[model samples]
Target chain A: DAGVTQSPTHLIKTRGQQVTLRCSPKSGHDTVSWYQQALGQGPQFIFQYYEEEERQRGNFPDRFSGHQFPNYSSELNVNALLLGDSALYLCASSTELAAGELFFGEGSRLTVL
Target chain B: AQSVAQPEDQVNVAEGNPLTVKCTYSVSGNPYLFWYVQYPNRGLQFLLKYITGDNLVKGSYGFEAEFNKSQTSFHLKKPSALVSDSALYFCAVSPTLAGGNTGKLIFGQGTTLQVKP
Candidate 1:
C-alpha cells in the first residue's frame, strides 16, 4: 500500500506571501497531522485533522491553518510567511484505533525568502 | 505542558559496538513515548513506542527502548551498530487529555547518531 504522500516537495516564497502544501494520507487512515521541522531541530506540531475538523492544535499562531477533505487528504496553508517560517513541513497519518503511532510523508520543503 | 528532551546533539560509535541514545520526557499524566529515526532528506520513521505494556519495547530494525518511569527516561539501545544506522533520532511524547490520547506529539531537539565503520 502507498504510504503518506505530499505535494510540492520543494517550494520557495517571499515574505508576506502565502503557501499551501498538500498531503494524501496513507490508505485506511483517517487522521492527518501537520508538523514543521526547522533546520537542525525536530519537528513541531502544527495541527491535526480528523473527520474534516481540527481535533488538536499546537502552539502555532493563526497564520497557520489546515484542511482535511472527506478522502482524508490534507492541505496546510501558511499565511504572511516570515523568513523564520522556512522549514520542512511534514504530514503524518494515523488512525484513532492506532492512537500513538504515525506514518509520515517525505515532507514539503518551504523556503520563505 | 508536555515536552521531550534528547540531551545529546550527536553520538558516535564504531561499527559492531553497542549504542544508546538517551531521552527523557515530561507530561501531566501517563506519557506515551516514541522514538523515530530520520535519514538525510527523509521524514521521521517510527522506531518504537512505550504505551502501557513492557518496559523493554523492541521495534523496527534492531532498536529497543527501555522505559524507566522513576527516571522519566526512555533510552534507545542496540546491541550492535551498523554504519547504515547513522541518522537523526528523535524522542517524542504524546500528550493525553481527559484520559484520551490527543495524538499530538511533542518532539525533542533530536540527536544525530554516527556509526563509524
Candidate 2:
C-alpha cells in the first residue's frame, strides 16, 4: 500500500509567478489537506478538500487555493507568490472528514525567489 | 478556538537517557491531541494520538505520550533516546469532530529535540 505522495519534490519560482503542487493521497483515503511549513516552524493548515469541494480553510488569503479530484488527489496553487511563500508545502490524507490520524507525504519544497 | 503550544524551542539529551518534549493545548470540548515529528525538509509524520480512554498512548519508534486533561497537556516521551531521534516535534489539537471545525488541526510552534551521542 502506497502512502501519500507529492510531486515536484522541489521547485523554484519568482515573485508575481504562480505555482501548482500536486499530491496523491494514500490508498483508501478520500480527504486531503494542505499545509505550509516555514523554516523553523510547524506546519500550518492551508485548506482542506472533501467531496471535490473545499470544506475548510485557514488564515491564508484568497491567493492560496486547492482542488480535490475524484481520485482523491489534490493540487495546491499559490498565485502571485512572494518571497515569503518559500516554504515546504505538505499534503496529508485521512480516511474521512472526522478527526483521525493523517498520513503525510514528503512534501514539495517551494522557493519563491 | 483550538490551539497548542510547545514551550521549549529546543531540548538536548544524551543517548540512552530518557527524553521528554513538552506540549500544552486548549480546546472547547473533548480534545483530540496528536504528536508529529519532522526530519529535515520532510513532512510531519504522525507519532501518536489521544482521543479517549487511556491517558498514556504508545506509538511508533518507542514514543509515548501522556494525556493530562486537568492540566491540558500532552507531552511526548521516549524511554531511551537515540542520536537519530534528533528532529523537530510538533503538538496539535483538533476541535470536537462534531463541531464546525471538521478536520482542521492547529499545530504548536514546534520543539527541536537533539539526542546527542
Candidate 3:
C-alpha cells in the first residue's frame, strides 16, 4: 500500500560532479519516468524506463541517464552537473501503458552549487 | 507537438468561494487531459484526468475538471475553496492512446492558487 518513494530527500553537488537520485515505484507498478521541475516552473519530462530499458527520452542532454532495476526501482544519474541542474527531480510510476495517471514520489531536491 | 497553457500565473480567492483554474491544450488528436497540484517544495499530486466519456470528471480532494472539446480546454474547479487549498497547479495533455500519440504528457507552465481567509 506504499506510494512511490525516493531517497536522500535533498542533495548538494558542484559543477562537473555527478549525482544519482533513487526512486521506488508504487506497488503494482512497473514503469518509471523521471521529470525535472525548476522553481516556479512545471515539471519537464526527462526520460522513461520500461522493461529495464529506456523506452523514451526528452530533450535532455546525454549527461542525463537512468536505469530501471528488475524490481521496478529507478535511478536517475546526471553527470557533469551544471548550476542549471539544480532543481527538484521527481519520479513517477504507472502500471498500464498509455495511462497518463501517474503516482509521483516526494522527489529529490538537487542543489548544484 | 503537444502543448498546454495555464494563462493565469496566479489566482487568489477568499475561503468558501468557488475556484477555477483555466487551462487550454493543443494536440494532433483527441486529448487525454490531466490536472495536478504541488504543495510547497513537493512533488506533483494527481488531481484528475479526462480520457473519454462524460465531459465532467471528478477527482480526489473535492476537485473536478470539465473537458470541453470545442474550446480545447480542461478547467479545474472546486465548489468551495479552503485555505489549505493554496498551491501550484498544472494542466497537461497528450494524444490519447486511441488517438495515436504516445502516452507521454506535455504540461503547462503552472498556476499558483492562493485561497485566502
Candidate 4:
C-alpha cells in the first residue's frame, strides 16, 4: 500500500509571502495531521483534520491554516511566512481506531529567504 | 500540559553492543507512549508503543520499549546494535485527556543513534 505522500518535496519562499503544501494520506487512512520539524529537533504538531474540518490545533497563529478534502488529502497553508517558518513540514496519517501512532510522509523542506 | 523529553542528543555504540535511548513524559491521566525512528531524508517509522499492557512492548526492527508509570519514562532498547540502525529517534506521548483523538502529538527533541561497526 502507498504510504502518506506529500507534494513539492522541497519549497523556497520569500519572507512575507504565502505557501501551500499538500498531502495525501496513506491508503485506507482518513485523518491527516501536520507537523513542523526544525533542524535537530523533533516534529511539533501543527493541527489535525478530520471529517473535512480542523479538529484540533497547536499554538500556531492564524497565519497557519489547513484543509482536509473529502478524499482525505490535506493542505497546509502558511501566510506571511517568517524565517522561523523554514523547517521540514511533515504530514502524518492515522485512523480513529489507532489515532496515536501516526505514519508520516517524506516531508516538505521549506526554506524561507 | 503534555510534554516529552529525550535526554541524549546522540548515542554511540559499537556493533553488537546493546543500545538504549532515554525518554520521559509529563501528562495527566494515562499516557500512550511511542517510539519512532527517522532515517535521513525519510519519514518517521513507528518502533513501538505502550498503551495499557505489560511494561515491556516489542515492536518493529527488533526494538522494544519499557514503560514506567511512576517515573513517567519510556526508554527504547535493542539487544544488539546495527550500523543500519543509525538514525534519529523520537519519543512521543498521547494524552488521553478525555478528548476524541484530537491527534496532537507531543514529541521529544530527538536522539541521534550512531552504531559503529
- Alpha-carbon interface RMSD for all candidates, in angstroms: 0.7, 1.7, 1.6, 1.2
The order by descending DockQ is 1, 4, 2, 3
**Candidate 1 chain A: worst-modelled 10 consecutive residues by lDDT:** A95-104
Q: In candidate 4, what are the lDDT values of residues A43-83, reduced to their tens digit?
A: 99899998998988898999999999999999999999999
Q: Per-residue error at A81 for model 2, in Å?
A: 1.3
**DockQ values, each candidate:** 0.86, 0.69, 0.66, 0.82
TM-score of chain A of each: 0.98, 0.97, 0.97, 0.98
Better of 2 and 4 by TM-score: 4
Error of 3 at B18 (Å): 1.0
Best by lDDT, which number? Answer: 1
- The candidate 3 chain A region of ten consecutive residues with least summed lDDT is A95-104
* Candidate with maximal TM-score: 1
For model 4, fnat equals: 0.87
Local accuracy of candidate 3 as per-residue lDDT tens digits, A15-108: 9999999999999999899999888777889998989999889999999999999999999999999999999999999975647888889899
Candidates sorted on lDDT, descending:
1, 4, 2, 3
Per-model TM-score on C-alpha atoms:
0.98, 0.94, 0.95, 0.98
Candidate number achieving the greatest DockQ relative to the actual structure:
1
lDDT, candidate 3, at A38: 85
DockQ of 2: 0.69
> Candidate 2, residues A1-113: lDDT per residue as tens digits?
99999999999998999999999999999999999988877889999898999988899999999999999999999999999999999999997744757889999999988
lDDT of 3 by residue, B1-117 (tens): 677889999999999999999999888678788999988867789899988899999999999999999999999999999999999999988565563545567889999999999
